[model samples]
Target: MQPKDWQKDFPVAEPQPFTQPHELPGPYGPPLIGHLLQISSEQSHLTLERWAERYGSLFQIRLGRSRLVVVSDHKVIQRILEQRPQSFRRNCVIEDRFSEIGINGLFTAEGEDWRRQRRTVVAALSRTRLASFFPRLKATTARLQRRWEGAADGNQLVDVCRDLTRFTVDVTMQLAFGVDPNTLETPGPVIQRHLEKIGPGLQRRFFTLFPYWRLIRLPPDRALDRAVKALDREVEVIIRATREHMAAHPGHGPTNFLEAMLMIAEHEGSNLTSADLLAHTSQLLLAGEDTTAYTMSWIVHYFTRFPEAFARIRREVDDLIAPAAALDKLEQANHLPFLDAFCNEVMRLKPVAPHMALETLEDTEILGCLMPKGTKLFVLLRYAATREEHFAGGDCFDPERWLPQPAGHGNQPHNTQAFVPFGAGPRICPGQHLAMLEIRAVLAMLCRNFDLRPVSHGKEVKEKMAVVMRPDHLHLRLKRRSLASSVPTCAPTAMAASRSGASHDL
Candidate 1:
């Protein structure tokens, strides 16, 4: 997909006049480093949930010297989202980190650049063009299905997160760069190991809460550097190769993102240099992979904990899809009402990016409070979804709440705003549709082929907020439906070759 010609014309908005804010209500911590030491980064969202109950939907919290205005109020989030690329922009820390990485994609870029980048990505993965990419998605899924079959055969305790990570990484590479690195079957788990470092590294830097990240060369930081550099280096080579390939084969362009961005760059919005292409592509790879992978893992975590939910999903799959049917027509996933509600429920319970930080680009009044410019805003996405005002039984896990009521039920309109799994705003995740497609396809296929039984590890599961919200464990056993009843079988392990300097096809 490519950017539309009109997106290039979007104009930057002027800053609004400042209005003095009344003394904001908050539990101000000690001089400077306010609530920084009190909350664990891993369970920060739960802490915010507790605070939301005590301090109301809107209150301030201290994390180091920073005074973060946390908003769990839906109306405030609505106001913030409604005013975008003008009164509100992503936090400077986010932009600076993207800059440090030498790339600014849709997420980090602001003003006209953000609009242009957003158009490029959305078009690339748009519904109109998604069909062409389905084969690549199916290929990777088949490999994952087979690998899981192997694990079930060995009675191995599969790490659902690790396997899902591999599946997403492969699909991302195939769709984003037209490359295939069959990670699921690859020995040594080359790409898996590298992608694993990224989330922990980014989370470490976020929690460090200082400007000396480049100077500190500790394991987490160093590992981050290595992982980022490795990914950047690979993307760069792909970009250059893509450029050469396009030059040699004029009028017949490449299929993935590098080609799409390059083709659109010459004639469209925000004149993108080679550097812009590299940065944008790299950022997509870095950001896209972690969030989708973690979200899928969280879905698994919920299903494992609640057997009834998994059973319902399996029944739905059995009813809708063929017993051993290949999940080829992904568009048909739309017809799956129960599965869709199931996904909605899982995300409501466990959103991957629980907190997204933005800054007040201008003095803005939200929910009757005037927040001045430069105010650090923490959009507590998860908390917003959990507020009693936003959702009934905010803490409970219920998929039926998302579904339409039966014929006998009273008429009560559902509060759609309660679910903000993908955040809200001009910068709300552009990749959400594609993410859901991948999750649904894999999930539909998994439930149809096998029965996933939770394996208790004695310890309760923990939410480790590493960049993305990740479950500390995915202890589940896969029982093949075929062996018990009647059936069939279905691949990227490419980072090793890249590490060894092996070139792959476009």
Candidate 2:
């Protein structure tokens, strides 16, 4: 359908009070529009938390003409995500915007199509495959270290998030397309621009008082359309290059993820056309890049905020690689207790994907409340994570909360349902393991090399939720640490040293 006709078909509905008997009540707005304008403009999770406290955990808010059910109860979210995958698909706004640039990959695909794509992508991102890809990850980390060194020397206040985004984008591009776009050194192509643009656009659509069909047609800006076209063109180029390479070489090179997909197409005697390839590649890039980078950035932010935790991590890195001169010893740094706790705490406090939207496929009852088919549900993950009832000192940035108590000690796994940073269910993030590895490795190196402090007024850095929960601006003053002071005098393993090259020295 053409964009205009599509808009007409999905006409904006007049807002009304939620009619369902089981729906929890929320503050309503004027006729034909609901609480959407209020909810979207303010912090959503905070708004939902307040409503839950007032009404209950499963409250209804009118999103345009649509009724959205927001749920923070762990049991309810788990059941919806795990037991009712079919009943809950991607929310309408996400599905529509992502589709514009051909994003029907595992993350957004549904039913049998989702299952097939997920199976192939998951297999490729499996533990064994990730281990093989470690060398590439390590290489990228090395390059990042060089970048950091240059920044430190120039006394630049680096936006750690942007740098990490570039690094992950580079890695995802290499892993998925076998082509290094080198976005780390330069601004990304049109697709990259769209990747950034589409996120805020989707967020706006989600919160808008009008349906997306109406919103997109009204000419505020054609930036979104332009971005979509740019993304499409970039993906098209990659698809064409892959096809040419396969036709010319035909079974000559080691099979990568793209090659594996192509092989499946060839064996099935199906022409897995360029569009399919473009869509899947776009999916892979979107899935792999933003979440990982955001997670890494959050970890750094938390480390800087909680200096004790930061100091402990630095000490752990030092102990793991006793000899400051031996970079190989850094491998042992991965096993440090404090480092693990710090990363977990960072995820708990600032989950990268704080809110996930799911749609109900059929009538279902959650927590004794009946939800009709096609209901939109917002899974409030970060609010769940930080609830006072979920953790002792829940609002405090304490890494020790994640650590195990000594044999006779008191701390046990705090039973909480709010900690689902990666989401829950059969459709949980497939790239989680790889993401953890990247985060842990990069964070380990960062602590070992730099004495990082937030900018003088940086303590006020508030998080603004976009596609990910990211700090609006993270300005860190990095002082390169002396190797001898940071690490012990012990000899390190060759691998660790090679990875933490002289670039670490400011």
Candidate 3:
């Protein structure tokens, strides 16, 4: 079945004559350094959102020498994203940083190179491939359930972010390389440790005024160097093992993402290289791990804060997939409308990629703003998504808004064009299907097996941006459901439980 066309229901804005981006309103920054001193790299997204509120949706800001056009207007952002490689390309700094450590891939490639890399990634993560890979995903999730059950049995405080990261890493490794790192069960020098160091380090370099690490390597810089080398070596071993596996089982089609890419490279000689393969393989682990994990973490946070929504989702999971430990078939996941809406709500509030940075490939007009070639564009992805003008009760976490409203609701201004969590148009994330599947499976499993409680010790869960936005110091305490309570309940059982006053677990 085809996915829903979210944008089709919303009204499209008409294009008009252009205006210079520099002519837009913005706050003042210091000389030469611009906003470098004003905004720190970690909380830059928050600063941009505040600035968007003070200034209009479209404005300009200077970060060091680069004067950037900051766009929070979703319509304009969609237009800019849709015109990719041709009119806009990913910011050069992103590619530079990724290449500096030898892991640049589809995320940073441009033009024909990007197109070629995109084809391999798209095919590898295609629906047909993901369907076949469902059993592996289910197996990984079952491992997670077992781990969480142990934690629940011990009444241990679960490090939600760390565990979720491990979960994604394991899933990505198996799905991409057909190897189960099993970070969920075993403890060792995992790739997640290195990734933790790299993401924030890259963010630091991206916002820094100068390349200070080149002249002098600080402790963190030295650590980053080690992490990069370690990750490269790790991926090298996996690549060699994968090649050996393919050699042994020669004639069959690609079983995993790495094999698929290797096949493409072998067939289309000179089109892809060894460096390209390594970079893209490493990129999948990098790209897949953090975003999905963090989003799931945020979902857990939301569940703790909004108990009613949590209970409602648990009810939905029980209605659909209860009596089973986890989702058995891929089609079973498609029946989860409320869980789907709940995730949409979470992503809308706390988008993992809160903003996207791109550079103008040529002179372009966005929302009537004249953007010169090489102009830096910082698209505030979550700003317009949470605004009252776009969504009703936009600040509140209301999953029902995503579900179809009743007929008498009289068409609330739910501007679907303003929402691009996985982005829009040609260069949208290729791994979105896999990401959503992981999210639904894990969330459903959590709701079905455990009751979630927040472990924040009087400190509010705050957003921290290290290339991706994630909650800081967030943790959860999981309570395993009794076999009787965990069973799929018919209407009479549910009503009886409701009447007995034993339905307050959320």
Candidate 4:
């Protein structure tokens, strides 16, 4: 059978109410697989938004034999994620796969394990630590600049997604394992192939809810097993080298994140095991690389689509590093208001993780709705971000929405909960600060060095949901912009600039 054919075999049912009429807003699902078919199809986010329009913000859908509550309302999401964290836990099916591989990292772990891991990560990724890592961030951005310059030298229409992926992978590898994957100069096929495979595997596991699938497990694919072994062996080598170095120089250690984890492992006096260290390090590599890279791709895509935003970003960069020779001043050049707003706007529209899943640990009442224990919940983050009620010009890419206004000014109400690109609640992404720093630095450099425009023949990039939200086949043409020109040649036309103030352009 073809991969998606099984979806057709599942029985579909009519929508029913899972809770009282006045409690939650929408109709529930049918017996087995309710609205699962509708949601699992292509561009599910848009489909969910349409459903939200029909059935209210909070609704229910059935996936195979499982029931899932879809929450798009900001108040309900905040309450569930923050006010009642104990009532919700990471989805078991998703967590179990990671636990099986000795990876009880924060993303997959639960309860005390999750809390400890989060605390450790938060300490390592705090604002102070991120500031300390600026030198490394600058170095990676420099490498990407060189690559972009070379690519544009031949006037080639390059895949910005591919370039961003390589750059992010290189930066993440260095930060996590202190090993340069050389994805920029020489891409590592082993790492790239395995990273791609992991996402599909995860998605398949997420879709399969029956316990029998795990019980009647078939033999593992030999090629995939071999790739896993190779990756594990590489990680082991790095761990061993780090241990040997720490022992030889005791107290004098590397300044990178991996070394910091090692120090924590020692200080914890047996609570932090070797497996824990390896798992956290690997998690960092996985989470850090693709998410940020995809975000940068979307940022570039938006800039191309809305050239006024691009021009604003370029102007910000130019002002920060005038004379175009202030390479050393890059670290101190992050105060650009428009650049910050632009990044926030991109995140608002194209959140890297579009859907976040949580499972109920106990029966609970949310906004007067009684939810049964074991019911899975998927917060439709992207849909919430695009709703007209939350954003003034819902579909348009407007950076000005994030700008701070004068006190008591009756502008559009700013709703941060509706824009959860890095997530909300105590379980929010710990690496958020580091990720933002990396994105801001790379985007700042790109805007300064080159003029980004969409490829004439390439299709307009739209959201493609994987482990991260990425642009599907985002091909962009780069024109090398000269700092010598007082008026940037690639600045948007007057009409294009004015359109950003309009509603629903996206």
Alpha-carbon RMSD, each predicted model: 9.3, 8.3, 6.3, 8.1
For each candidate, what is the lDDT?
Answer: 0.71, 0.68, 0.82, 0.67
Candidate 2 wrongly placed segments (more than 4 Å): 1-23, 187-194, 211-221, 252-254, 322-334, 407-413, 456-459, 489-506
Steric clash pairs (candidate 4): 16-28
Model 1 residue 503 CA deviation in Å: 41
Better of 1 and 2 by lDDT: 1
The TM-score of predicted model 4 comes to 0.83
Best by lDDT: 3
Ranked by lDDT from best down, the candidates are 3, 1, 2, 4
Q: Per-residue alpha-carbon lDDT of model 3 for 1-506, expressed as tens digits?
A: 12223334333452233557667788998878989887889999999999998987678888888899888878768877887878788889899988988888889999998898788778877888888889989999999999999999999999898899999999989877888888898877678888888888888899988889989999879998998888888888888898888889988898777898888777777676667778888888889999999999999899898889888888877877767877888977776767777788888889998899998877666665667778888999999989888888888888877666679764666776777788777899888888889998999999888888788788889999988988999988899987577665664122211111111111
- Candidate 4: where are CA atoms >4 Å away? 1-31, 187-190, 209-227, 267-275, 325-327, 330-333, 404-409, 456-458, 486-506
Q: TM-scores of the models, in the given order?
A: 0.87, 0.86, 0.92, 0.83
Ranking by TM-score: 3, 1, 2, 4
Across residues 1-506, which tens digit of lDDT does each residue of candidate 4 receive?
Answer: 11112112322232342353234454455667655656653356666667777877667666777666776766667666773357788778777766555545668877777776676667766777666666776877888788778878988778776788777777777765667777666743646555655554445456543534446544433343454556566677888888887888887854666787788768876577777777777767777777888888888888887887787777766666654522344344446667777877888888878777887777665443456677688777777777777787787887877665556644575566577787778887777767777777788778777877677464656776665667887887777778687343443322212112211111
Worst 10 residues of 4 by lDDT: 497-506
Native-referenced Cα lDDT, model 2: 0.68
Error of 2 at 111 (Å): 0.4
The better-scoring model by lDDT among 2 and 4 is 2
